[model samples]
Target chain A: MNIKVLFFGILEEIASTHEIIFSDIHDIKALEKILNNQFPDLTRYKYLISVNHEIVKNNALLKDKDEIALLPPFAGG
Target chain B: MNSKFLVSGAIQLEIVTKSIASHSNKLNIGAHSVFLGQVRNDVINRKKVRAIDYSCYQEMADKQFQKIKDMIFNKYNDLTCMHIKHSVGQVKAGEISLFVFVSSGHRIQAFKACEETVNLIKDEVPIWGKELFDDNTYNWKENK
Candidate 1:
């Protein structure tokens, strides 16, 4: 399974890419570990995971071509 | 629906006026509540903010905006219409960044719906802001 993860706001600056693909990722937890290891600076900020446009708190399983997004705290009014 | 939720440059004053004018035929709407968010030139850590650069995950943001509209309309049955606009790219201080308008048959429902909608938008939207300072320093704005 390949997961397409997007980084937004400051997370994009930390990750240095707008989007990244993780191959054969088992679940969201595993993906987070990989992201933390890849971009240690991203660990400092708080963010949420949105799978296919909805925020998910639990360890949601990833599927092939799942569009995952790393969103920082919202600031819209 | 896409027209109602906008992510564009600074909102024009004419658009606001036109929106209000367009609602004249809706006799059922007795009240309207509006909320406008402007960029402030606040000094933070000795740096004065010059502008705000906004960005968002557009596909997700569009969906979230629609969901919010549906939720608010369902919760406030008397609500007649809801219009939301948010800025993208650079918006200078004193410029309009966000505009939310809600109309209803009564004043109370309009006020409540508008307030709740603004709060929900600030919390749920994936939009992000980069606060640019006069001294070339920058900070990411976090919702409080």
Candidate 2:
């Protein structure tokens, strides 16, 4: 299945803002593993994942059109 | 049931109104709360903020904004309308970085809703901004 992934903050600096197409991922955890391997710098920062606008745990199941966004904590007031 | 909500990553801030004349209609709304977030020129360690380059996980930020809206709607009883705007890219100090407007049947609820919404955005939104110092250096704020 193809999922849309978004990156922000230092993550964006490491990974450009665009969707990556993954062919065979069992779950969100697998996706995270793949990403962490590609961009090891992201593992150092605290982040959250939203599946279709709802915050989900690492094991959340993804749908075809579901939009996944990787958000680092925000420091704005 | 009537509201104007937008989520974007551009650098412009405007008064968002679905219909301009809707403001004049006092039939439903008794009070309105407006909160504006301006970029500050100072950060920790006495470093002066020259400008802020804002960026976001747009897909997630929009989702988070919508969730906040839904939460406010479910929690408030007298709210008539709400709107949230955030700036992306470079924003100079003293310029508005965010705007949260809420209208309710009374002043208390409007004020409370606006404050809550802004706080939620600051705490939950996936938007990140980099602070540029006057000395031609920049630092990215870690998400908290």
Candidate 3:
């Protein structure tokens, strides 16, 4: 399955504001490992992953065309 | 009672002037509390901030703001109306980032409601801004 990854904050500096396709990821943790390996600089940033607008923990099932967003902590008033 | 609110990414401030005026007139409100959050040129370690890039999880931020408004309405007795506006995208130093307006039958409730709403937005909304500095360095404000 292909998953879309979104970036924000300094992460956006390292990775452009576009989604990249990852083929055949088994779980969220595995995807995280793949991303960290691909972009080692991301390991230093604090972020949260949301699958289809809902925050998920563990290896939640992902389907094609699912919108996944990576959010850095907010800093607005 | 009516609540006219707006949530958007555009730079223009939201206004519910007609609703506010009508409500205040009906309630005979005598006081209005307004808080405006303007972009500042100062950052930590004496970095001079030049601009701010604001972004938000729009769906969640809108819901959160509406919830905060409802909560304030329930907690305060004399509030006639309230409004909140937040800017997205690049905002220069000295530009207004947020504007909160509240009118009440008395001064106390208006002040309390304004304070509560601003604090709630800072604490709960999923809006993030990156500070661009004169040195061309940028930092994201992390929640503590």
Candidate 4:
């Protein structure tokens, strides 16, 4: 399973890339752990997770080639 | 282009004019309330904000807008119309970045719906704002 991870806002700045791909990830929690290890700076800020364009909780399942986004706190007007 | 909520460089006055013009024939609408959010040139540590670069998870944001629209319409009995436009990319300070309009049969409903829509959009939408300072540096704006 390959997961497409997207970084936004301060997370994007810290990661230095808009998106990246990981080879194996069984669920959202696994992906989070890998991401935390890869970008340790991202752990400092609070964020939300989106799986295939919908925000999901920690127990959400992951599928192959799923697009996952890490979103910081919203700042819209 | 298909979505009602826009994410452009900057929302133009003509867009607002056209939106109002399109609703002219809807005679049931008696009152309209609009809220325009402008980028401030606030100085932080001697560095003034020159502009803002807005970004979002577009697909989710569009879905969220649809949900908000449905929720607002169901919650407000008299709301006749609603419009929301937000800026993406770079918008200079003092420019309009967000435009929200709500119309209803009475002034009170329109005002209440407009305020509620603005608050909900700010809290629920997956949009982000990056403040670009005049000194060629930037910071991510946090929602207050």
Candidate 5:
């Protein structure tokens, strides 16, 4: 299953890119581990994970073509 | 024209004026509330802030705007109309970045809806602002 991952705010700066594709990732926890291993700085800051535009409080199961986003603390007015 | 949610640059005074004038003919709207958010010029580490470069997750932002508008209207059924516009690109310090307009039959409803809309947008919107300093440095803004 191909999954699309998105990075926003400071997370985007740490990831060095806005998006990436992952294959074989079964859940958010697994995705986190892989991303942490690849981009160690990403683990330093707190962020929220959203699966298919919905914020997930816990590990969420990922499906094919699912879009995942890592959101930093929002700074809007 | 840009979408209803995101404006490409600073919210123009003319647009705000037009928005208010457009509702003038509606005899039922006895009250109109307007909220404007301006970019602050701050000195961080002795560097002055030049502008704010705003960005967001567009697809999700649109969804959140719709949700907020629907909820606000449902709660204040007497509201005649509501409009929201937020800046997306570089907005200089001292310029308007956010605008919320609400019109209702009574003063209470318009005031309440406008305040709630501004607060909710600040918290729930997926927008991010990078504070660009005059000394070629930057930091992220923290909403208070």
Candidate 6:
């Protein structure tokens, strides 16, 4: 299975890109572990995880073509 | 249902004035509440702020704004109209970056809705600001 992960705001700088593709990720927890291993800097920041545009508070099952986003704190007015 | 909310750069004064002038035709609306968010000049890490470069996750932001509109309209049945515009690019300090206008049949509803709308935007939208300083360093802005 393939998943597309998007990083926004300061995560974009920390990840060094906007989005990335991963393989063999089955669930949100697995994906989180992979991200922590690859981009350790991400562990320091607080953010919300969204799967396919809906914010998820807990681990969610992932399928092929899922678009997961790491959204940091909002600063809008 | 209006999705176009991102405006490039600073929101000009004329835009606000023209929006108000155009609402004259809506005779039923007795109260108009407006909110403008200006970029503030602050000293960060011993450097003076120069400007703010705003960025957003456009697709999600639009959907979130629509959801907020729905909530607002449902909560305030007397609301006649609501308009919002936010900056997407660099805006100098002291320039206008956000414009929110709400119209209603009474002043209290308009005021309450306007304040709530602004708070929702701040808390929900997927927008970020990078504060550029005089010495060329930048820091991400955090909402309080």
Q: Which candidate number has the best DockQ? A: 1
Candidate 2 structure quality by residue, lDDT tens digits, B81-123 = 8878787778888887788889889999998999999989989
Sorted on TM-score, best first, the list reads 5, 6, 1, 4, 2, 3
lDDT of 6 at A23: 89
Query: Per-prediction TM-score, please?
Result: 0.96, 0.80, 0.74, 0.95, 0.97, 0.96
Question: DockQ of candidate 2?
Answer: 0.57
Clashing pairs in 4: none
What lDDT would each prediction earn against the true structure?
0.88, 0.76, 0.75, 0.88, 0.91, 0.92
Per residue, candidate 2 scores C-alpha lDDT tens digits across A1-77 of: 67777776777777765567666665898888999999888788788888877788658877776677777778654
RMSD vs true structure, all candidates: 1.5, 3.9, 4.5, 1.4, 1.1, 1.7
Docking class of 5: high
Q: lDDT rank, highest first?
A: 6, 5, 1, 4, 2, 3
C-alpha displacement of B48 in model 6, angstroms? Answer: 1.3
The per-residue C-alpha lDDT of model 1 at residue B100 equals 92
List ranges where model 2 is wrong by over 4 Å.
Answer: A16-19, A62-67, B1-22, B142-144
lDDT of 4 by residue, A1-77 (tens): 78899998888888999999988788888888888898899889899998898888667888899999998999986
Candidate 1 vs 6: which has more DockQ:
1
Quote the positional error of residue B105 for candidate 1 in Å.
Answer: 0.8
The parts of candidate 6 lying over 4 Å away from their true place are B1-3
Q: Which parts of model 5 are misplaced by more than 4 Å?
A: none
Q: Per-residue error at A67 for model 1, in Å?
A: 0.7
Candidate 6, residues A6-63, lDDT tens digits: the string is 9999999999999999989999999999999999999999999988888999989999
**List of clashing residue pairs for candidate 5:** none
Q: Against the native chain B, what TM-score does each candidate's chain B reach?
A: 0.95, 0.84, 0.81, 0.95, 0.96, 0.96
- Single-chain TM-score of chain A, each candidate: 0.96, 0.84, 0.83, 0.93, 0.97, 0.97
